[model samples]
Target chain A: MSSLDLRNLKINVGGKPIVKDFSLTVPKGEVHALMGPNGSGKSTLAKALAGHEDYEIVGGEAFLNGQNILEMETDEISRAGLFMAFQYPSEIPGVSIANFIRAALTARLAENEELDAAQYYRRLYEKMDLLKIDRKFTARSVNEGFSGGEKKRCEILQMAMLQPQIAIMDETDSGLDIDALRIVSEGVNTMRGPNLGILLITHYQRLLEYIVPDRVHVMWDGRIVRSGGKNLALELEEKGYDWVKEEVAAV
Target chain B: MPATIEKETSSESIAIDRDIGNFKYKEDYSYDAGTGLSEKTVEYISNVKNEEEWVRDFRLKALKIFESKPTPTHWASKDLENIDYSKIRYYLSKGQQPSRTWDEVPDDVKETFERLGIPEQERKFLAGVEAQFDSEAAYSNMKTKLAEEGVIFVGSTEGLKEHPEIFRKFFGKVIPTGDNKFSALNSAVFSGGSFIYVPPGVHVKQPLQAYFRINAENFGQFERTLIIADEGSEVTYMEGCTAPKFETTTLHSAVVELVAMKGARIQYITVQNWSENVFNLVTKRGMAMEDATIKWIDCNIGSRLTMKYPGVILKGRGARGEVLSIALANDGQHQDTGAKMIHAANDTTSNIIAKSISVGTGRSSYRGLVQMPKHLKNCKNNTECDALLINTNSRTDTYPAINVRGDGNSVQHEASVSKVSAEQIFYMQQRGLSEAQAMSLAVNGFVNDLIREFPMEYSVELKRLIDLQMEGSVG
Candidate 1:
């Protein structure tokens, strides 16, 4: 029911061009994995799409369900049904995870409408269960004193609760052990539905083994150089990103 | 719902409190004793109260001291000079009996508390609640079970006259009249504050609450509070203050003295929300004896100017003291608050945590002092004061004085002043929260560490107040 359309996007950090002439789209009912090595501008693109102020959007027009999102504020973009699961979520002290998610959900409500706390808690507990997280996790401050795996799982929990139209997951598999990796991947797989579009950015193909993407794109030097089916992920994993760079240079 | 659409806009009406002055009670004081302070005023107050000779003499002596002392000159709250001692009515009371039931209270008085939800809160959480209207307490209630446990809770007047054996010993010993100019004034004309005495070895689980309101214009609300927790007993007392806006400035000067006997624990909490035209000058201190603990949890918001420093003196082995404070200053307001910890005995410890938020051109200052004399050994103190400025011109200042004269005493003081970063706000906004909500969340997060020191109901009320205060805090 929703679609993310990015046409020739450019992003700069600290006045230096990082993501140059990038273009990609993950339509509803599909999962697209953008795989690249370190410093390949994958994270920058994700942050810019979420309207992070630090990532100066140089030239880009992102449309979410036919709505122009480039001119909108960060919160406006979020309310328009765009989401980003950060690689390193901030640890807000004294703000419990329950309150944080509740605020996020409440922000989407109309001014006169009130949030149903009972139904909210019911859904929150259900999400926690689906993500294999303890109900006690809601009591702790968001990401405060949490383990690496715990933080990543919290991101998934937020995604489940928000249920945005398009979700950009940045390195959701990084910093996660084998056990946490599978659980996070399972959450993504279960979340893959016709009403949701996902762009899972990762450095490794192991994440794709759990939630196989419909399309695999290998990015090098801030641009996607190769695109193929899920088989491309296996080929890229067998050969390093250096092989993709060589293949692109040969052209 | 509190925000009103006012067609008239004045430059001075720029603060966030553009609409909220619903707290007003009809005034029909039978004994208004006119304005101005004199020996006759002191005699009139004592006479009205039917006080004993010693109490009357105490008032007269305090009045002299108050007259002799000068207003503080070098304080950050420059508005202190604006108080007109000559025009302030020293005493105003209705001469009505305090009712144990709400129906017996005057309609206007009951409605004021009802609007403030005092009765509901008391029924929900507190074991006892007392209310001070203008100059005297008009209502008091206590759960019979708690009263049966020898927990004495009454107004200062009744406490002094009825329980002299308990109140006489520790009344003036903690904070003497000569402590400060405002305390001297309070000692002279003080009335209608909570007087709580917990018998030895009895623990009062539910907190005792006091609600103080200023309903009469040009009337000075001076309430002297004395709380004594006997040996091995524990009690927590909380108070809330609210005043309506007046064309002329109002004055609220209170003195609170707390004594924690051997192995006793006492915690005192204050939440003050005064109108914009009020000057709140207060003096509060506590004394902790052998193996006792005393804590002051104070929050100051919505006053034109506030100058208060809650202190504690650790006087016995293993005695402990702490002061956790939160201050918020909006436009046309000055919040100058801090804490003091004095170590007087071996193995005594204390801690002070103060957090302040300044908006627009408002100013918030932290002035802390911790001292350990030479004779005190194995004493420790930790003082941390953090300030958050919401605007470019908002001001914050920290002045911490730590003096350690003994070999085994250690003191630590940490202070920081920071602004809410645009990046943090953006991060929160990206999660669909508005800019104002993001800012409020960040500010509340800063003081979240210290607010945990409060009771459950109080912390919830504080959070709601913060959210309401943050509605227009950011431009």
Candidate 2:
């Protein structure tokens, strides 16, 4: 089993501190919901943990199963079992989905080793079927001309294929409808097990109703200020974020 | 000056597995017109070919025209100044008619093509094969099924000797000697290129292949190619070139003229991987009649300096033309290529898509000319050129001359120069692809829309070549 542990993390973007002194840990078998309002710096935290170069870690310690990832390059961190599903995935025109994943898998192989086309496609079709993705989608350019729902689905498809130990889905529910949310949530839920730890970042409590998380943490002004069980998400949904802001102001 | 092939790869990781572009040259010249271009050199070439008096006179007139014209000074590259005309041998060949059978072909010539995989390719995908050594074709063969259907695939000399009735009608008419300085010189010393004539209503199912090899240094390979697709006929011709590296430079100046009669279609594809020391200057143009179509799909990967613009004239109602090209310029190379489209009739259409990659200090440019006169009603044209720079010092330029006088016509031009973005690389790398594979995929994707027009085999090899070019550029 693997885990994603972040301790006293401080992150800056373009010389401006966005996330400060944030600490959270999602163990191997559980999903943690990080709920925050806009400008809460959730994305900056996710990007920094994924080793994005722009997300400067002024002070932080991140580990993928005790392997320091803050010191590694973005790609190296990925190979070290960290994945971030983008809120707005980039469109790669003319590169088919099949080929993109194949390249990634090929990259992970030892030098001079090759991917077996037959077994690879067999596994791909199986996963595509599980996600209800059309067989023809594999031939289309990655995320090019895809709808919002389709983009999220494709991201899930990639996560399924890459099989990362810890996946931070940044706004995976953002722009998706109720039906699409159910499908994408189902795709992620199927992958949640002892081998996969998911950090579901969302602005709304609506997603947690479908894919319930083991714990909920409220992020405000960069760091997590409150922590509770699954009921915290429902309380935020009823009380709205202003209640938390007022509480923090009083404190 | 011995001709050798220098395979350049800065990183062992790139070529260690792919091992492409490892071509070598072996010379066996039986009729060497030696170094220097003069009336005597022209006369010696004509005598060796045993040409008729009229053809000899045509060569003399073209040579005189070539002498009178000055080198083109307005283009992007000035490497022409380095070509020592007096030191370049005009013609060299293994003295014999091109045999139809591979067994009769000279051993050196056969072995050279064997390395290049010509005969094997013929067996796999081609319907015809013409392998030219320096100045003359050493082997020319066509599938008997195509020959039975009146598809004539032969060397230019044989085309002149046997089909004078057809050859004389369109030899220099489309691209005459006075068209340009290079065309004039090619007309004077041209030899060994393919002469394809598809008769009315006959469609060649498979593409005809021609391989041009330059095996000697300080030599110029001037090959003239002419293709005529008669009414309602269709044909595709693919030509490949591989030259040897030498201390001194070589010149490959070719003139290709194509004519598509009413309702016919012609597709000409070129894959030029000349050595870095070769100056590849060429003039290629085609005329499309009523309801006819002409397409030029060209890929240029090697050479010190290349300046070529394959053009098409849409001369009749409803005619269509297209030029799809990709150029890769490595260090010490400049690829100056583009397309030309002229609309002379109503309802004519044309499109041009050119993509280029510049590595290190290499430079790539697109120069295009599109014209539609006022009288041509409802003529339309579209041109696009995109360039990718691989390094900080890599260079790219665009010069498009568009004159759309036709009030009822429309013209559109689009061009972009971009470096492969670090963000794009990161996106790919996040998926676990190495830097080289990511860059290679980006380059391939840049031209993939046009590359899809190539045959599957060609596209695969083109992808490999691009991978080789992209290697070592990024860590």
Candidate 3:
């Protein structure tokens, strides 16, 4: 019965407001899609929710499972069951993907508790296989010199491993081809269950074809102006975002 | 938990100079052999060790040269100028002879070595252990199998007395006393260091180790070591050093000379963690004959100032040399370490990779030289030096010299200096690691390539050391 509630959240970057008065509620077993054109504050909202240091919350309140998350450190926020998949993942050279994920998992365990190596590897290999990643990917450095598609797959792999309560994917389909997008979508679909809430941010309706979101919200000018069922994504895709801007201007 | 708490409580009262008496050799050795460049002090040392006339004259000549030469002014730190040579004790050794068994060693010296993890490593896997307390080796032992195979492992003093033929042949040929001011000083009053000799065609599978402990104040420890690998023989040597902290500075000027004969291989590894009050200046060099190989793996962790450059001379055809070095400089420490490679013959190759990290106002510098002679055709050399500054107050410098005279020689040099950026820390923090933990991971990642070259146990200890350095790096 986990949920994330964002109440009238406002976010700014570089002294300019990006997300203004944004509100969203994602309960367990629900998948929400944030649809917008470029520069529509969708990524800013995701980053703000993840407690990124650069995205200053000018006025906002974010909660994870009834616990206020804005006051926690970024790492604490992450350990509190919030995970963000970056549009451009960082390349940590010489740090193996296995070690990095193991460290994150290790941080979550009780101080005196130890992880079973065999079971851990077993789970890791299963996740990698589900993502279609090669077994050798475990030894490779995290996102270092990886292709765009490979980076996205790695992000999904991490989400599968950490199994956070709320997973925010920021433009997860950007630079991904049809094959990669389908694979990444399938991996996410496999992890969707009663205890997980997902917020997928994307610029186009193409990703929606595979993920099949339960709810769609159109963000325009730092605010979610429209919210509806999945039909909203197809309607918005048929007509360009200019139509929405024109309608808003007429109002 | 009780042991850990006891250790913590004991560490609180452990001043830098509290363990001076742990240097048992200082207690029994008479300090009357004062710091004088006279024939008498040399004669006293020679008489005390019962050395032959040739060895005694060698010391006298070295002493004369040491007195005439002035300390170098251009290289190294100016703090070395304050070393009061007149006030330093030359040599100090316990009255007992070098023991082959750990039980025969004095209790104080044995306890110091035990605390340093020497006995544990020896009992577990070491092929031999030579523990030097103060100025002389208190205990020296090698596996009986190695002795039966004609592998000579003993103190330099014992080697001079027993195997003078082999000792006299290659004593100062690689690193002469005139090579540096510190080398000259070491030549004059050098006491106890390991002397290893591997017979022709015999390969020693395990690594021999030497542990040096300096436990007395104002006492200079000058240990000279020599290793000769005969034709087709292979051997590896490891050395670790630690000294008690003292209010007054102590001088440690050691000289190590190695010779690898035709088709032989020699590897030398040194891990030194001296206290902040000690000046560690060492000169180590090796000569590689036809088709021979030599490697120097060095890690410098703690010292007020350290100036050490392990050099290799490729004197025969198809010879090869390599140096892998890592230095970590904490507060008030200066690690000036690098390598030197000289290609004197055709078809020789050499490589140098040096990595250093500086934290908390510490400074580390890489000064390297690679030279290929004009007549040496088909020679190749690659030099890479990188430094990582962990804090705003820390600094790093690189000074590399590459000389290639022949057209057929290929020489490449690359150097870079980078500091840990705030964005990197933020990015790592976003992945669920604390600021301090992020800093440690980044630093470890920075040196991961070089660290993988170390043994598994040493790599683990190095990571722990890096973690300790990163503990207070962040608020």
What's the lDDT for all of these models?
0.87, 0.89, 0.86
Kindly provide the TM-score obtained by chain B of candidate 1 when compared with the true chain B. Answer: 0.95
Query: Candidates' DockQ values?
Result: 0.52, 0.53, 0.54
Whichever of 1 and 3 has more lDDT, that candidate is 1
In Å, residue A9's CA in model 2 sits off its true spot by: 4.5
- What pairs collide in candidate 1? none
Task: Give residue B356's lDDT in candidate 3 (0 to 100).
Answer: 93
Q: How do the candidates rank by DockQ, highest first?
A: 3, 2, 1
Candidate 2, superposed: residue stretches over 4 Å from native: A7-10, A15-24, A37-40, A58-61, A70-72, A110-119, A218-227, A235-251, B1-19, B26-28, B244-248, B358-361, B387-395, B415-419
Model 3 TM-score, all chains together: 0.91
Q: Report the lDDT of model 2 for residue B240.
A: 91
The residue pairs that clash in candidate 2, if any, are: none
Give a tens-digit lDDT track for model 2, residues B1-475.
3344234434534543544433445555789998899989999999999999998999999999999988777655667888889999999998749988999887767777876789999999999999998899999999999999999999999999999999999999889888988898888888889899999999998999999988878989999999999999999999999875677888999999999999999999999988789999999999999999999999999899999999999998999999999999998899999999988889999999999999888999999999998887899999999998978899999999999995899988888887877777777878877678888988887888889999877888788878877774565
